[model samples]
Every structure is written in C-alpha cells, then in structure tokens.
Target: MIKRKWSILFLLGLSFASVCQAGGDIDALYSRIAQKDIQALNELKALAKDNNAQALAELGFIYEYGVSVSVDIPQAIKYYEQACDLDGDYGCFNAAYFYEYGIGTQKDITQAKTLAKQLREKINLSNINLDKKVSER
Candidate 1:
C-alpha cells in the first residue's frame, strides 16, 4: 500500500510537471489565436484534422465568434461536434448549449439534456476517483 501510494504520487507529480512545461506553449498558441495570425490558425487547422480535440475546440470558438473567419454558427457547431466526439468536455458543453438554444442547429432540448447529464456523470465519476485516491493515501 505504501509503495502504491508513492508510485501514484510520483506519477501525479510527473504529469503536473509536464503540464506546467506545456503551459508556455499553450499560452503562445492562445496569443497567436487572439491576434488572428493566419499561420497559427493554419497550424491549428492541421492539428484539428489530426483529431486534436483542443485544436478543434479553439477552431470552433474562432468560427463561432468571427475572430478571424466570418461568424458561422453551423461551422462552429460542426467543429464542436468533432471535438466532442474526441471526448473534449468543453466542446460537449458548447455543443449542448447550442442545441439547447437552437443557436446553430435545430432546437433539441432532449439531446441537450442528455449531453448535460452525461457531462455531469463524467465529472462526478472523475471526482469520485480523485476522492478514492486521496482516501487511499
């Protein structure tokens, strides 16, 4: 039990360190996106094509808000759908919101409700797992 606890802690610490190291790159990408840099957008698009959920979500936001491309709710929704299919929670949330409000797609309260429930369950499960881990320690 002690060895398992230490192993978990080590893995968590390593993951956290990697996240911290990637923060700078993520910030740079966001900055480029905010500036509407075409090169950065192209790179993101390529990444999205490779099934990068974060890239897809960012592209969805760009299209939704007309940051660089003209505002196209349908396109945004499509990107969000792709991201959600890749298990991106933010994408799922945005897609659900759009469905609920009929922003881009037809109003589908049932679908939205289902998605929201799924998201809730996923979050709950994640929390439960974290709690169990903590308790084990």
Candidate 2:
C-alpha cells in the first residue's frame, strides 16, 4: 500500500513538473519576443505544433503586421482561425475583425458576430477566474 501511494505521488509530481516546464517555455518565448530575437520565431513555430494558442496568436500577429517578415494576410487569417479554435480570445477577436471587414477573407457578418460573442464570453470567464484567484489570495 505504501509503495502504491508513493508511486501515485511520484506520477502527480511528474505531471506538475511538466506543466511548470511548459509554462516556463512559454515565458521564455515571450521574453525572446520582447527582445525581437529571431530565434523566438522558431520557438513559436515549435510551440504551435503542440497547438499552443499564444504561439499561434503571436504568429498571426507577426504575419499580419509584417513583423520581420513579408505581410501575409491569408496566412495570418489561417493562424488566427487556428488560435481561435483553441480558445485564444485575442485570436478570436482578430479573426472576427477580419471576417467583418472582409480582410483576407470573405465578408461574413454572421460568422464575425458568432466569433465576437465567443470572445466576449471567454474574456468574461477569464476575468472571473482572475477575480477568484485574487480573492483566494
């Protein structure tokens, strides 16, 4: 029984460590972005492979605004859509804006409205979670 308990605790600790490591990687990626390090682009691409929403959203921004690369509106829209599907609220808003204005996509007010609503809900939920954390502290 003691061995089983120890094994369960070890597995839990391993999972927590992995989660922390992923968070650290994300933080490092943001730090690289702040420095405009070209290596950050590669890191972002790698993270996107795991469907990291922040990485996808950042990639969309980079492509959309021609940050250190040629402007590619279609590519930006694709990344934004992927990020939005992953529940990245900023990406959802960007995708919705593109759909609404027919920028890099066909004008679809209905789709834009749907995405806008989803983004709003996500923001609300995030705020609530933040509030809970603050209160707990």
Candidate 3:
C-alpha cells in the first residue's frame, strides 16, 4: 500500500513539474511571437508541435489568424479539429465557431449546437476543473 501511494505521489509530482516547465517555454514563445521574430517563432513552433495540446491549438490560431502565414480557413478548420479531438477548450471553441459561422463548412445552426454540446461533454471529462468555461465557449 505504501509503495502504491509513493508511486502515485511521484507521478503527481512529475506531472506538476512537466506543466511548470512547459509554461516557461510557452511564455518565451509568446514573447518571440510578440516581437514578430519569424525564425524564432518557427523554431519554437517545431519545438511545441511534438508534445502539447497548446501547440496544436496555437497552430489552429496561427492558421486562422494568418500570423506569418497565408490565411486558409480550411487549413485552420483542420488544425482546430485536430486540437479539439485532443480535448483543447480553445480548439473546441474555434472549431464550433468556424462551423457555426460557415468559415469552411456551411453554416448550420443545428450542427453547431450539437458540436458545442459534444465538445462540452468531452471537455468536461478531460478537464473537469474548467467545466464552467465550456458554456462560455
């Protein structure tokens, strides 16, 4: 029993440590992006793409906003959908919004509402702490 408890604690600690490390890089990336350093941003993006939900969501945002890239709504939709599938709230919101607004897909209110509900349910299961934000999205 003590061994099991120790293992759990170790895992929890590691999880916290990983999250903290990720925040530092994310901050640095944001700063680079703010400075409009395209080369650094691309390098940071490659670093991010391997290991995070945020990376995928940021990819979606970049495609959506055309930050240092061409605006391609279909590509934006594809990236957002990828992040949404990975349980990202921002991704879910953007995906549903694009679908709702007919940015890529045809506007269909019923489909939008349905996807919104599905995203909320999935987000609830994956990120229980932010369930309230689901409705806001």
Candidate 4:
C-alpha cells in the first residue's frame, strides 16, 4: 500500500511539473474557454487527440458543464478517463466522482476506488475529496 501510494504521488508530481511548465498555454486555453471560443475548443480537441493530459481534462470539463456545447456526461467521462490514464490528478478525481455516483456510467464502487486511489496522494485542483466520498459509500 505504501509503495503504491508513493508511486501515485511520484507520477502525479511529474504530471504537475509538466503542467507547470506549460502554465502559460493552459492559462490561455482557459481564457479562451471562459470566453466560449470555439477555436479554443477545437484546439483542445486537437490536443486531446495527441493524448495531452491537460487538454483531455479541459475537454472533460467543457463537456461535463456544457461550456460551449451540450452537456454530455459520457463524453466527459471518456475524456476524464483518458487524462486519468495519463496521471492527470484532476481527471482522476472527476472520473472517480462520476464513477462513485454513477453519473454517466453504471455505479461501480470498485472502479471509483481505483481511480480515487490514484489521486489520494496528490494535491489536486478539484478539491472534491474522492477518498472521503469513497469511504462514505
């Protein structure tokens, strides 16, 4: 358990570092997203196609909240899972949330637990405590 925890932390830390390195691009993307820019959305889609973790997470957010498109929970989950697979902490947390509540997919506590565990050791942006949520379930 301890070894797994350390590894998750290590992986998330690496992801966080890369995000920090690209902080300017992320901010610009969010700025465009906030303005409902279709170009930015397209850029995100392009980035997601390359398996960009941050872009995948952003696309998940856009789909989940209907920023410029209709709400598509399943699509959001798909993007979030992709980001999570790349060790994006935010993606892991959000995907875990959906799994925990069965929002887009069937309720799967085990899957939720697995996803949440990936974020438990990281300082994530979501601020939604997946560990607490999973424990309460």
Find the candidate with the highest lDDT and give its number.
Answer: 4
| Model 3 ranges off by over 4 Å | 1-4, 44-51, 125-137
Q: List, residue by residue over 1-137, the lDDT tens digit for candidate 3.
A: 99999999999999999988976776677667766778756865685466466776777777778766677788877777767777766777788787776877787556556556667687566544232333444
lDDT of 4 by residue, 44-109 (tens): 788889888888998899899998789999999999999999878889989999998999899989
User: For model 3, how big is the CA root-mean-square deviation?
Assistant: 5.0
TM-score, candidate 4, is: 0.73
**Candidate 1, residue 136: lDDT:** 33
Q: What is the TM-score of each candidate against the true structure?
A: 0.71, 0.66, 0.70, 0.73
* Model 1 lDDT tens row, 1-137: 99999999999999999767654554567679789788877877887898977778888998999987799999998898788878777787788788777887898777676666555564565543322322232
The number of clashing residue pairs in each candidate reads 0, 0, 0, 0
TM-score (C-alpha, index-matched) for candidate 1: 0.71
Over all chains combined, what TM-score does candidate 3 have? 0.70
Where in model 1 is the C-alpha error above 4 Å? 1-15, 19-24, 125-137
Which model is ahead, 2 or 4, in terms of TM-score? 4
Candidate 3 weakest ten by summed lDDT = 128-137
